[model samples]
Target: MTGKKKHSEGEIETVAPAAMGTAEWQAEFLTQRRLDKARISARFAGKTLDNFSARDKGRKMLVHSAQTYVSGFNLNKEAGGFPVYPKGLLMTGPVGCGKSHLATAILRGVIEKGYSGLYYNSPDLLRDIRATFQPDSDLTEDDLLEEVTTVDLLVFDDVGAENATGFVLDRFYLIINERYEGCKPIIVTTNLNLEELENRLGKRILSRMLEMCEIFGPFPEEDWRRRNLR
Candidate 1:
């Protein structure tokens, strides 16, 4: 619904009123489901841009990029008439460089903004897809694919960590390609360098990602996890 407001300068402006009643309840319900589907583990559940440790200059820059991405995301545009192809983020770096943390933080931010979001570790996502072939499995391949393709945002973590089998490559391409064709956005975190990732996921997938995403760096070489253990 919309309402008209009279301005002090004698101008009338029309504005959309906030959702109420069933609309409000339904919006919250869908938001909750998106949060659950994100499946962020306990380790990263509390990770947010505000809490992300950015002690160093590079880290601070990365955090700023993430914050800017989230702030620029427009759910209304996504749901509007025009076909909006949202730009995604690809965070590539060495092990324990906090790529996953930043990705999760971004996902949480978008989900809280009422846009649907999903998070899946690359290997775990493939395993779940493969399981759909089991006769007694509750999920079908289409079901999984539909969710990944239609969601407003998808966070795919550990991109090159999955085994590069024929089936894996086919399904991986399908998911990425579908999202690409639909103009949906995705957030990816990977430990593999460009050469290694191209080899693991193939040139086609890498090319699609390059066009669709804004690449974030080969972060600090030091392993933050190892440092924390010391």
Candidate 2:
């Protein structure tokens, strides 16, 4: 289903705060910026993680999923805000249902709580990587690899939105496969159901994803966007 464009994808934009000293204040300041990363992660989770969506006189509430709890990811949290684990979240639901928001909310919240994070849609991220192929582009494979491996958190919205071309699938596999070896964490939101996910993610990635992260609730009240639009 088409989303109602209720959530602001732009909210995740964060200016990297700077620090250039060993002073306690400077160290703390840098830590705060690092936390900004996690804040973005948490926000991503809150907005996209399934919440019930309902319209009431053209207004929206953007509810949260009752079946979910953030603390359960404690092992994940204790390891490091986005632990860069082999497995990460794989949110499933209809389009415009806040799957992306959940990812965004979590990213944002975690950053706010003092952690690092990175966010991007799957296709856009791939596009950026492809652009680096140009001779004038400064980004190297190492740069692409770092985003997946070094970031505090890596968020992939619309995981399979790109056409499932062999090249695209291969690229997707490479990132996930490498991260699996490194034990990095990731967050993925998709407008696909269980069957569709099985089809799109394939058996391998699906197994890794499930092994790494818990499935957020996809209940009737889980669409936060619908609430906002109302």
Each model's TM-score, in the order given?
Answer: 0.83, 0.65
TM-score of 2: 0.65
| Candidate 1 lDDT over residue span 67-130, tens digit each | 8888888745644666466699888888888888899999998898878888999899998998
Candidate No. with top TM-score? 1
lDDT string for model 2 (1-230, tens) is 12233347655443333333447656577666665544244444345323423454222322333223233333243345444223467777777655666567566544544456788787877787789899998889668767666675677788878887777777777877776666667787788776787698688877776775667645343355465566
Highest-lDDT candidate: 1
Model 1 CA deviation exceeding 4 Å by range: 1-30, 75-82, 228-230
Query: What is the model-wide C-alpha lDDT for candidate 1?
Result: 0.86
Q: Name model 2 segments beyond 4 Å from true.
A: 1-28, 35-87, 221-230
How does each model score on lDDT?
0.86, 0.62
Error of 1 at 40 (Å): 1.5
